[model samples]
Target: MDEFEKIQKLIRLKKYETPGEQFVDEFVTAFRERQRAEMLKQPALSLLWESFRAWYDQLFSPRWTLAAAVVVIGFICGFAFMPRGGQTHLARRGKAPDHPAMTLSLGKDQTGKTLPAFSIETIRVMGEIEIEPDPGLLSKHFTGGYDQIVIVPHDEADTAIAVPYDFIHLDGKPDIR
Candidate 1:
């Protein structure tokens, strides 16, 4: 006979014997009992520990961990390097919006208040001035703003320029300005 015919004959004769129902039931019961015993042998973790483990699992889940990490890192970097108020203009290299909305030119036609003529020496002095407070706009001026002229020497040059030091805080203190 062929191999296929021989295999069919063996199947018809029930040559492959399985365990009896009683033995199967006993084996399953023993298995369950052993499993229960093994589980009972290990002590339960504390609520705090269990919660931390759960949180850690969720935080590191493969489907979301990378995206979540990127978002968290982005937020940290943005806030850490973000410029404070009133300094954003300086950070962007733009004119400060708080002071001097319009540039006054020499020889006014309507007001007739002859704008001071700009000279080369005066312009050089103006360039040395690090900060200038608007005396007209008290609200826009720095905190503790007052009329006090103090001359400070430039670090890079031998020239001494006058500026209100309180108005030129490097740390940008809003309360002091």
Candidate 2:
């Protein structure tokens, strides 16, 4: 006989036996008992998990809490140090010059003309007029030969006058005040 056939014949003739029935029953019973114990502990484990989640939320629940605190503090500081209406703390500290008093008046002329009078300790003009367009022709309709005219107040004289009454060209230079 060949070596392979001999080995196969020996293996066939050998006895193959399973574990005893009592051992299998005991093992299964122990496994079932252990599984039951583990199942009984699941409720406690779930309770612990819920408690951990609650603790975490309590620790970090303030969304943007630091930012909110900073804004509130800033508001409090601003209100505490801000100037009141019509008055300034800087003025009280003498860091700024005192404002001068001013007076305004309106009177009528002998010819029944309304006149506006103003008096101020200090007067400043933020902007000045250069070439003023004609006020008389502002309401008139556009014509082919119509030219733009401007009225400017004379600094030396009290009355206002136009440089060119009819047709005048400005050299794009402002008149001296």
Candidate 3:
């Protein structure tokens, strides 16, 4: 016998049962029907839903959201502790009462003449000043025109004795000096 005839005879003898063609056709039909039904259904608010999900995801992430919160807290704390322009605790406590009105006259060294204007204000002395008379100007004027002014608290009256020049000296250190 030929190879093809022999193979066909062996197949017939085995009597193997194959799946019904109707089963495959039914499965394909059902799959197509389900796909058509889903395609026909309307999606409500799909665009809005997608946008909301994207925004929600970004806001919940640690990097951007946590940094924004920290910056807001820093600004609040900065404003709370910042000092106002004219209100200072150190000036209020250590300011000279009488000499609150103090002035320093700045003038030309070569000429004995005083300048037209000068500054007068409260002195807040924190340290000592060494006064050496300007020899060049002393011949023309008895007192040195420009002298360093030292400001100290009013209660440190005894400490004021260290300064030499009369024109630039405080009258007396306050008890609270």
Ranking by TM-score: 1, 3, 2
TM-score of every candidate = 0.33, 0.21, 0.25
Q: Model 2 off-target regions past 4 Å?
A: 9-15, 42-177
What digit string (tens of lDDT, one per residue) describes model 2 on residues 1-177? Answer: 999999998988656665677988899999999989977777987878878989866876577667777899998998787533223323334333244322223344569785543322221212221122322332232222213222223456434443332211122222222
Query: What residue runs in model 1 are displaced by over 4 Å at the alpha carbon?
Result: 1-15, 46-61, 70-177
Q: After superposition, how far is residue 158 of candidate 1 from its true place, in Å?
A: 9.2
Assess the local accuracy of residue 17 in candidate 3 as a C-alpha lDDT between 0 and 100.
75
Query: Residue pairs in steric clash, candidate 1?
Result: 142-177, 143-177
For every model in order, what is the number of clashing pairs?
2, 4, 12
Candidate 3 on 1-177: residue-level lDDT in tens? 999999999889766676676989999999999987865663657656867899978768877778888999998997677543222334445554433343444444457665433333332222322222233323233233333333323354334343322322344433222
lDDT of 1 by residue, 98-120 (tens): 44322222343357665442211
The candidate 2 region of ten consecutive residues with least summed lDDT is: 122-131
